[model samples]
Target: MSNYSTTTLVMTRVFNVSREKVFDAWLNPKMMKKWLFTLEGTNKVAQNDPQVGGTWEIVDHRDGKDYRAIGEYLEIDPPKKLVLTFKMPQFSDTVDTITVQLKELEQGCEMTFTQDIIVPHEETWTEADIEKALGEYHDGSEHGWNLMFMGLKELVETGQISYKG
Candidate 1:
């Protein structure tokens, strides 16, 4: 197997919601539609099968284009930990894995989100080029996840959330 460089993007958030509720948001189609990562789009397709090996897919319809996020569950421990693959076929063929770990707090819970970003080096690309590309991906991903986290916070806190909000 070829060894490629890997970088992790880690983010943590304290949600004022129970662990199960926060964890369920990652699996439920309705909740996922409201808070999962997406570009600027009002229409979304969220199909999730919350099981050890089941796959989940989300498609965002925006500006006459569909952006799909597809993945398979690698591990699932209710209200505690979840591991899954995440890939956007519209962009790159590289597959990445994400882990969501939730710890119950006195009031609510803290979620630690981790994603492994494997840098794909093209034959003609230099080391600097690879590093630059990785930076862009990391920054863009962090921004998108932050937006989705905001929506999630709203959904769990207020029982309603929207992409536009």
Candidate 2:
């Protein structure tokens, strides 16, 4: 066994738009800043390169603080799947991988989003400890992603960026 255990955050959302549009928004600079990891009125600097091995960074400036998210494209299958490394240096040095999968539906598209949360597998870490941490992460992360998804859904369907986040 490795020295780490993975806790995956799996969530799905449906959008009233094409998967291509949803996928494009992830790469588009202007569209990204409107939603990706941001608060309703917070400003962010987004730098993204969508090609495989390319890196991305989004720094959110809120309440006189800069919260940064850095990642690299590990795999990209446009309109269908994307895999990237997600890291918030200020929070942790642990680099996690996030995978997004999209499938076309009659109404629109469904996005299956997931993030791999790696926990140290030290002998001292009891099962209870891991569960407790996961509980906290699940609530915070799920809430944040829901807000972002709302923003994305609105942006793509209405051609307007409302900071639902």
RMSD to true structure for each model, in Å: 2.0, 2.3
Instruction: Report RMSD for candidate 2.
Output: 2.3
User: Model 2: which residue pairs collide?
Assistant: none
**Over all chains combined, what TM-score does candidate 1 have?**
0.92
Candidate 2 per-residue lDDT over residues 102-150, each given as its tens digit: 9999989999999987665557788888787777776777888887888
lDDT of 1 at 163: 46
RMSD of 1: 2.0
Candidate models: Cα lDDT each: 0.86, 0.84
Clashing pairs in 1: none
What stretches of model 1 exceed 4 Å from their correct place?
A: 1-3, 38-41, 162-165
lDDT of 1 by residue, 16-114 (tens): 989999999999887887778652245467888899999999888777788899999999999899999999988878899999999999999999999
